[model samples]
Target: MRVMVFVKATEDSEKGFAPTPETMAMMQAMGKYNDELRNAGILLTADGLKPSSEGKRIAFDGPGRRVIDGPFAETRELVAGFWLWEVKDMDEAVAWVKRCPNPMPGPSEIEIRPLYEMADWQE
Candidate 1:
Protein backbone atom coordinates (compact mmCIF):
# COMPACT_ATOMS: atom_id res chain seq x y z
CA MET A 1 0.00 0.00 0.00
CA ARG A 2 1.09 3.53 -0.72
CA VAL A 3 0.37 6.20 1.84
CA MET A 4 1.00 9.89 2.34
CA VAL A 5 1.95 10.94 5.83
CA PHE A 6 1.50 14.59 6.71
CA VAL A 7 3.19 16.33 9.61
CA LYS A 8 1.02 19.23 10.65
CA ALA A 9 2.41 22.67 11.36
CA THR A 10 2.79 24.30 14.75
CA GLU A 11 3.04 27.94 15.78
CA ASP A 12 6.82 27.71 15.87
CA SER A 13 6.83 26.25 12.40
CA GLU A 14 4.72 29.09 11.06
CA LYS A 15 7.20 31.66 12.32
CA GLY A 16 9.51 30.79 9.42
CA PHE A 17 12.58 30.74 11.59
CA ALA A 18 15.41 28.23 11.71
CA PRO A 19 15.26 25.27 14.00
CA THR A 20 16.94 25.34 17.39
CA PRO A 21 19.67 22.92 18.37
CA GLU A 22 17.19 20.63 20.09
CA THR A 23 14.99 20.75 17.05
CA MET A 24 18.00 19.94 14.91
CA ALA A 25 18.75 16.95 17.06
CA MET A 26 15.20 15.76 16.70
CA MET A 27 15.51 16.19 12.96
CA GLN A 28 18.66 14.12 12.98
CA ALA A 29 16.82 11.39 14.82
CA MET A 30 14.08 11.64 12.26
CA GLY A 31 16.68 11.30 9.58
CA LYS A 32 17.88 8.10 11.15
CA TYR A 33 14.37 6.76 11.18
CA ASN A 34 13.99 7.75 7.55
CA ASP A 35 17.19 5.96 6.77
CA GLU A 36 15.92 2.85 8.48
CA LEU A 37 12.73 3.00 6.48
CA ARG A 38 14.64 3.54 3.30
CA ASN A 39 16.95 0.66 4.05
CA ALA A 40 13.91 -1.48 4.71
CA GLY A 41 12.58 -0.43 1.31
CA ILE A 42 9.44 1.14 2.71
CA LEU A 43 10.22 4.81 2.27
CA LEU A 44 9.63 6.14 -1.22
CA THR A 45 9.98 9.84 -0.60
CA ALA A 46 9.98 12.35 2.25
CA ASP A 47 10.30 16.10 2.50
CA GLY A 48 10.07 18.94 5.02
CA LEU A 49 8.57 22.18 3.87
CA LYS A 50 9.59 25.70 4.73
CA PRO A 51 7.41 27.86 6.94
CA SER A 52 3.96 28.77 5.71
CA SER A 53 4.96 32.40 5.42
CA GLU A 54 6.85 31.57 2.25
CA GLY A 55 3.88 29.83 0.72
CA LYS A 56 0.80 30.89 -1.26
CA ARG A 57 -2.62 29.55 -2.01
CA ILE A 58 -5.16 29.64 -4.80
CA ALA A 59 -8.86 29.41 -4.12
CA PHE A 60 -11.08 28.10 -6.89
CA ASP A 61 -14.80 28.60 -7.28
CA GLY A 62 -16.61 27.80 -10.51
CA PRO A 63 -13.57 28.60 -12.62
CA GLY A 64 -12.71 31.74 -10.67
CA ARG A 65 -9.28 31.74 -9.09
CA ARG A 66 -8.18 33.94 -6.23
CA VAL A 67 -4.56 33.93 -5.12
CA ILE A 68 -3.82 34.47 -1.49
CA ASP A 69 -0.49 35.17 0.16
CA GLY A 70 0.86 33.05 2.96
CA PRO A 71 1.68 33.33 6.65
CA PHE A 72 -1.77 31.85 6.64
CA ALA A 73 -3.64 31.50 9.87
CA GLU A 74 -4.82 28.23 11.41
CA THR A 75 -1.52 26.56 12.18
CA ARG A 76 -3.37 23.38 13.01
CA GLU A 77 -4.37 23.03 9.38
CA LEU A 78 -1.03 23.61 7.75
CA VAL A 79 1.41 20.89 6.74
CA ALA A 80 5.04 21.12 7.79
CA GLY A 81 6.30 18.00 6.10
CA PHE A 82 5.37 14.76 4.43
CA TRP A 83 6.48 11.23 3.72
CA LEU A 84 5.44 8.77 1.07
CA TRP A 85 5.76 5.14 1.99
CA GLU A 86 4.92 1.81 0.51
CA VAL A 87 4.17 -0.83 3.05
CA LYS A 88 2.47 -4.19 3.22
CA ASP A 89 -0.64 -2.86 4.96
CA MET A 90 -2.00 -0.31 7.37
CA ASP A 91 -0.64 -2.27 10.27
CA GLU A 92 2.88 -2.05 8.97
CA ALA A 93 2.52 1.67 8.44
CA VAL A 94 1.16 2.04 11.94
CA ALA A 95 4.16 0.16 13.29
CA TRP A 96 6.48 2.58 11.54
CA VAL A 97 4.65 5.57 12.95
CA LYS A 98 4.86 4.11 16.43
CA ARG A 99 8.63 4.03 16.16
CA CYS A 100 9.01 7.61 14.94
CA PRO A 101 10.31 10.22 17.33
CA ASN A 102 8.03 13.13 17.98
CA PRO A 103 8.46 15.52 15.05
CA MET A 104 7.64 18.68 16.92
CA PRO A 105 8.71 20.36 20.14
CA GLY A 106 5.36 19.94 21.84
CA PRO A 107 2.18 18.22 20.81
CA SER A 108 1.87 17.71 17.07
CA GLU A 109 -0.05 15.63 14.56
CA ILE A 110 0.68 13.26 11.72
CA GLU A 111 -2.02 12.09 9.37
CA ILE A 112 -1.74 9.06 7.12
CA ARG A 113 -3.89 8.50 4.05
CA PRO A 114 -3.65 5.78 1.47
CA LEU A 115 -3.29 6.75 -2.15
CA TYR A 116 -5.37 5.31 -4.97
CA GLU A 117 -3.99 4.24 -8.28
CA MET A 118 -5.87 4.29 -11.59
CA ALA A 119 -6.46 0.58 -11.38
CA ASP A 120 -8.66 1.06 -8.34
CA TRP A 121 -10.74 3.85 -9.78
CA GLN A 122 -14.21 3.08 -11.05
CA GLU A 123 -16.34 5.21 -13.30
Candidate 2:
Protein backbone atom coordinates (compact mmCIF):
# COMPACT_ATOMS: atom_id res chain seq x y z
CA MET A 1 0.00 0.00 0.00
CA ARG A 2 1.04 3.59 -0.62
CA VAL A 3 0.32 6.46 1.69
CA MET A 4 0.82 10.20 1.73
CA VAL A 5 1.91 11.63 5.03
CA PHE A 6 1.07 15.28 5.50
CA VAL A 7 2.89 17.60 7.86
CA LYS A 8 0.30 20.18 8.78
CA ALA A 9 1.32 23.79 9.19
CA THR A 10 1.31 25.77 12.39
CA GLU A 11 1.32 29.49 13.10
CA ASP A 12 5.10 29.52 13.24
CA SER A 13 5.35 27.76 9.90
CA GLU A 14 2.92 30.18 8.28
CA LYS A 15 5.00 33.11 9.52
CA GLY A 16 7.93 32.03 7.34
CA PHE A 17 10.38 33.07 9.97
CA ALA A 18 13.97 31.98 10.45
CA PRO A 19 14.61 28.64 12.08
CA THR A 20 15.33 28.71 15.81
CA PRO A 21 17.49 26.29 17.78
CA GLU A 22 14.49 24.17 18.72
CA THR A 23 13.35 23.97 15.12
CA MET A 24 16.87 23.08 14.05
CA ALA A 25 16.94 20.23 16.54
CA MET A 26 13.60 19.04 15.27
CA MET A 27 14.92 19.09 11.72
CA GLN A 28 17.90 17.01 12.76
CA ALA A 29 15.69 14.45 14.41
CA MET A 30 13.44 14.35 11.37
CA GLY A 31 16.47 13.77 9.16
CA LYS A 32 17.45 10.77 11.23
CA TYR A 33 13.91 9.41 11.06
CA ASN A 34 13.84 9.89 7.30
CA ASP A 35 17.11 8.02 7.03
CA GLU A 36 15.59 5.15 8.96
CA LEU A 37 12.62 5.07 6.60
CA ARG A 38 14.84 5.16 3.54
CA ASN A 39 17.14 2.44 4.84
CA ALA A 40 14.11 0.30 5.56
CA GLY A 41 13.02 0.77 1.92
CA ILE A 42 9.68 2.31 2.81
CA LEU A 43 10.25 5.95 1.86
CA LEU A 44 9.48 6.80 -1.74
CA THR A 45 9.88 10.59 -1.49
CA ALA A 46 9.64 13.42 1.02
CA ASP A 47 10.09 17.18 1.02
CA GLY A 48 9.21 20.32 2.91
CA LEU A 49 7.37 23.22 1.29
CA LYS A 50 8.14 26.88 1.56
CA PRO A 51 5.69 29.07 3.38
CA SER A 52 2.38 29.86 1.71
CA SER A 53 3.48 33.40 0.94
CA GLU A 54 5.41 32.05 -2.00
CA GLY A 55 2.52 29.95 -3.26
CA LYS A 56 -0.61 30.55 -5.27
CA ARG A 57 -4.04 28.97 -5.54
CA ILE A 58 -6.37 28.47 -8.47
CA ALA A 59 -10.06 28.24 -7.74
CA PHE A 60 -12.41 26.64 -10.23
CA ASP A 61 -16.18 26.99 -10.46
CA GLY A 62 -18.06 25.54 -13.37
CA PRO A 63 -16.12 26.76 -16.42
CA GLY A 64 -14.70 29.78 -14.65
CA ARG A 65 -11.46 30.06 -12.75
CA ARG A 66 -9.97 32.60 -10.41
CA VAL A 67 -6.36 33.00 -9.31
CA ILE A 68 -5.77 33.72 -5.68
CA ASP A 69 -2.48 34.76 -4.19
CA GLY A 70 -1.28 33.36 -0.96
CA PRO A 71 -0.44 34.21 2.51
CA PHE A 72 -3.69 32.30 2.78
CA ALA A 73 -5.73 32.25 5.96
CA GLU A 74 -6.35 29.31 8.29
CA THR A 75 -2.82 28.32 9.25
CA ARG A 76 -3.87 24.98 10.66
CA GLU A 77 -5.24 23.90 7.32
CA LEU A 78 -2.06 24.61 5.39
CA VAL A 79 0.37 21.85 4.51
CA ALA A 80 4.00 22.32 5.46
CA GLY A 81 5.37 19.23 3.86
CA PHE A 82 4.70 15.64 2.84
CA TRP A 83 6.10 12.17 2.43
CA LEU A 84 5.12 9.30 0.17
CA TRP A 85 5.72 5.85 1.56
CA GLU A 86 5.06 2.27 0.62
CA VAL A 87 4.00 0.21 3.57
CA LYS A 88 2.40 -3.15 4.22
CA ASP A 89 -0.80 -1.55 5.46
CA MET A 90 -2.30 1.35 7.36
CA ASP A 91 -1.12 -0.23 10.61
CA GLU A 92 2.47 -0.12 9.43
CA ALA A 93 2.07 3.51 8.44
CA VAL A 94 0.61 4.35 11.80
CA ALA A 95 3.47 2.60 13.56
CA TRP A 96 6.02 4.60 11.59
CA VAL A 97 4.26 7.89 12.30
CA LYS A 98 4.17 7.04 15.99
CA ARG A 99 7.95 6.75 15.94
CA CYS A 100 8.50 10.10 14.20
CA PRO A 101 9.98 13.04 16.05
CA ASN A 102 7.91 16.18 16.45
CA PRO A 103 7.80 17.99 13.13
CA MET A 104 7.34 21.33 14.79
CA PRO A 105 8.76 23.02 17.86
CA GLY A 106 5.27 23.34 19.26
CA PRO A 107 2.17 21.18 18.99
CA SER A 108 1.59 19.92 15.44
CA GLU A 109 -0.10 17.13 13.52
CA ILE A 110 0.67 14.53 10.89
CA GLU A 111 -2.06 13.13 8.69
CA ILE A 112 -1.79 9.81 6.90
CA ARG A 113 -4.01 8.96 3.94
CA PRO A 114 -3.95 5.98 1.60
CA LEU A 115 -3.58 6.47 -2.13
CA TYR A 116 -6.09 4.93 -4.49
CA GLU A 117 -4.54 2.57 -6.96
CA MET A 118 -5.92 1.64 -10.38
CA ALA A 119 -7.26 -1.58 -8.94
CA ASP A 120 -9.54 0.39 -6.67
CA TRP A 121 -11.20 2.07 -9.66
CA GLN A 122 -12.23 -1.19 -11.26
CA GLU A 123 -15.58 -2.73 -10.38
Candidate closest to the true structure, highest lDDT: 2
Off by over 4 Å in 1: none
Q: Model 1, 8: alpha-carbon shift in Å?
A: 0.8
lDDT of each: 0.91, 0.94
User: Top model by TM-score, which number?
Assistant: 2
Model 1, 6-92: lDDT tens digits are 999999777764778988899899999999999999999999999988989999999899999988988999999999999988889
Give stretches of model 2 more than 4 Å off. none
Clashing pairs in 1: none
| Native RMSD of candidate 2 (Å) | 1.0
CA RMSD, predictions in order: 1.4, 1.0
